[model samples]
Target: MEGKNIIYLNDIDGKTRAFTIKVKVVRLWKRSNPKKAGETWAIDMVLMDEKGTKMQATVWSNDFKKHEKILQQNECYTVFKPRFDKNNQKFKHFDTKYVLTFNLETTIRKCNNFIGPTHGFEFSTFKSIKNGGVSSEFRTDFIGYVEEWFAREDTTTRYGKQSYKMDLILRDLEGIALKLTLWEEYCDQMQEYISKNKEEEHIVLIVQFGSVHDYKGTINVANAYYITKLFINERNEEIVNFKRSYIGKASVTTSTHRSIGQSGVTSNEDEFLHNTTFSTIRQIREIAQVMHVIVVGTVMAVDKDSEWYYLGCESCNCKASPSLQFPEDDNGSDDVDPKEVLVCTNKKCKRDVVPAVHMYKVSIQVEDCTGIVNLTLFDRDTVKLWGLSAKQLVDKYLQVSDDEKTIPAEFNAFINKKYAFKIHVKKYNVDNKVDGFSINKLVDDPAIIAKLEKKFDVVPFEEFDSMILPTTVSSSQSDAGVKDSKSYAVDDSTPLPKNYESRKSPCDLKRTLEDSNDLDNSYSVSSTKSRKIETKEDIKAQMKDKLLIPKLEK
Candidate 1:
């Protein structure tokens, strides 16, 4: 009964029930061999019996002359055989045990039996089960923070209008879970629910059915399907424990399942990834002007000279303990350490790989949108546009210590300094939490590489402008003890050289100067302030430097 070749068996719900179902027939159609749609008998309708049991009422020469009343609209009869509609894409079934027919084979009976609701498969309990495949339709209460939301498009047609869709990550008491696709009108409603409450606060919902289809070994839900109801039912600490039938025990069939829903609305994207509103490279540059954008992908090649930072393990945040510089290479031997290192921050690489170079190079990764593509920092141009370092720009988004410098244990465990460092992280992010998730205008234009590069004077890595300078020197040489002195038309109290002025002050000027000197050494004025002097050497040297040029090679 549990395997195959079985009838009158207990259903998946564990209900021990069987019935000799009955049916009353008012109308029937004889399935025929008349070719329709280039096929013989494209599955015509069926008439079932009063016991809900099936028997073929074949349309033959005998039936054409029999049971004329069953074809009448107001007339009724007891009939046999049932036909279920089949979608072309879905597998079609012809009930072999109860073949469909036309004319009645039995008497019409008036029995009292009606269809009942709440009929579906049962699911296994999530607890007390380590792992197994899950299949069922159920109802249960569940809660999860809004990790992410995907809204779908809708359209209209001759069969009235269509609807939208929603995909979300739903976590519960059992554990983190996978994709829940919402169909029809529920899609739009879920969209509104998501936009309003995108934070990590718990949200409760009831799931009717899901995990019906496995896409790429990952459960995926599509439109034209099942239903799930998500609502904020009663808030206690804004959390409620309810039940959903769709939620059930999921078992690990294998490790390559590529877990879904774990990367929900708030789930950190791949380490070192920065998803931007911009999709094109042009757009990437526009945002790079003010904010540094970094997306994480696989390492095609590490920078040749990239400094390797040591970590304890690839999968642990426990940084390796270290002393200082490497011990001097004694006895003409090379220096090496046994420490494990990471070129990237992925804490899960199975093997150690080094960065290809010191300068930022493109990393490749497989993404749903762009497969096996490079993720870059928009550096080629934005480095010149925005002078802000990616590190400093990221600092503004950091949630600073407001608890009187008491560092949270999670952060303290990974950090060794009191201040921000150029430490790489598992996620590249915009300070969306800052200012209502909208970065300031300074960070809006992502293509500001040209603007950023202007702030730093670009010199070769080894060249230093402020460190040293060389210049041509002549008469006024500091190294030769030359000092600039006040210039005068003539030396004081001495006969002037030929062509030098030796003129004495006029009698009136002399009298005024004598009176001014007699009154005070300073009348809020210094004697040097009034002195103005120029020399032939100063003008000739200035002109020569501006105009002189060496002769070109002949």
Candidate 2:
């Protein structure tokens, strides 16, 4: 092989020929086989050449000691007398067509004259990953700043082994966010770094050989064992330039900055609606590039044609469909029994079906006096508005007979009722039309509800008690002071109508009581109407006088 020319990965064939190549070991791992009890372990590696081509190589247990110590990661080496074989696509993670297997005749030596980069990576944008069609055959690279992260947790794997997982929210300069999941050793390393750098507000992360996973309608980036490499706040040229492009600049600030509750935003609607402008459905469409707007409309229709919830894989939360069932075997024999399973369509997770979770994705048409528009409510906001979790809604809807083919009565209560919705809008097309709208917050404040009732001629359930009290009083007993009394008395103490049970769910009742308690505890000797208009200073003073506020002891 002295005079043989070096070949790239694309030129590899099964023909026996003498060849010499220089490459670096980018990744290394071990696989075990139960059949060979005495010698079960085999070393596997991913190698990359100067031309940025990669290939998979394996060293069986018989030849492990011969080359295990000689091969070092990120170091160039020259190898000869290697044999090539057809790659098993199911087990291959590299982009090469063939894989290398080491035999007793193979020779490995350190390279002294070669000058090239240790590793080469092809970076992908968040846009492409989010648009779907990311092949699982090969891995990709990603770089972004860590916006937020969750605490490390221990989870039980399908094999009954305990594994640790950490989830990180990453955002790029284009204002796109993606979830990155690290497992086992990677999770430990990240958690260690986070503990050490507790004072740092932002951290830049670089992920190599990370795979894309689709969960429901969202895209996530995950790490593969042994093949994935992570660099956190490293001082490399590429990292330094990426940091400079975003740090200490207004444009970068806007792109990287996010609100405290941006992920879920489950706080009271009053906080979000404080400074927002209220608009009708028609006016909402006329505005351009408005981030948040409030709208009051009657739910004209609930979309029953579309599914209220979807089955998602428990591990990755990707949408899954029922697997095909075969009643008989291929030979037309009835020995095989038919069974149902949920199959994940996402190529990244093609395992045997597992237990699935319910995810909400509901669309409803809302109409105001001016115009009508269709709005969508995702998981969090849907739970808030419907007063039920996705799982609860699925259970309730499935209880009905299949032939009826209608939504639950709880959903029908939403129709012809008024609500103050806080929506986030995105404009699309040349005409600047509002193409995307999602319910961000659900308002139930009496002040806001009263204002909407007066302006839009719509009444909420909470205000119905006040609106009908005056009409129910007898004219003979009416007095000047009767209008000032906030209490209503009935001759009999019978229970309310049964229709009220269908009008509100258990969660709605709990929320109403919580709101009432919040108002009572925050005010002193002030009526509901008076407390609504009180300024921040007045409320603070009232709280200080009536309640003992705790102070931080620093």
Best by TM-score: 2
**lDDT minimum window of 10 residues, candidate 2:** 523-532
User: Against the true structure, what is each candidate's TM-score?
Assistant: 0.23, 0.45
After superposition, which runs of candidate 2 have C-alpha atoms over 4 Å from their true positions?
Answer: 1-4, 33-40, 158-160, 248-554
Q: Pick the candidate with the highest lDDT.
A: 2
lDDT of each: 0.29, 0.60
**CA shift at 80, candidate 1, in angstroms?**
6.6
Model 1 lDDT per residue over 36-96, tens place = 5443342223233323332223344455445443343212232322121123322222223
RMSD of 1: 30.8
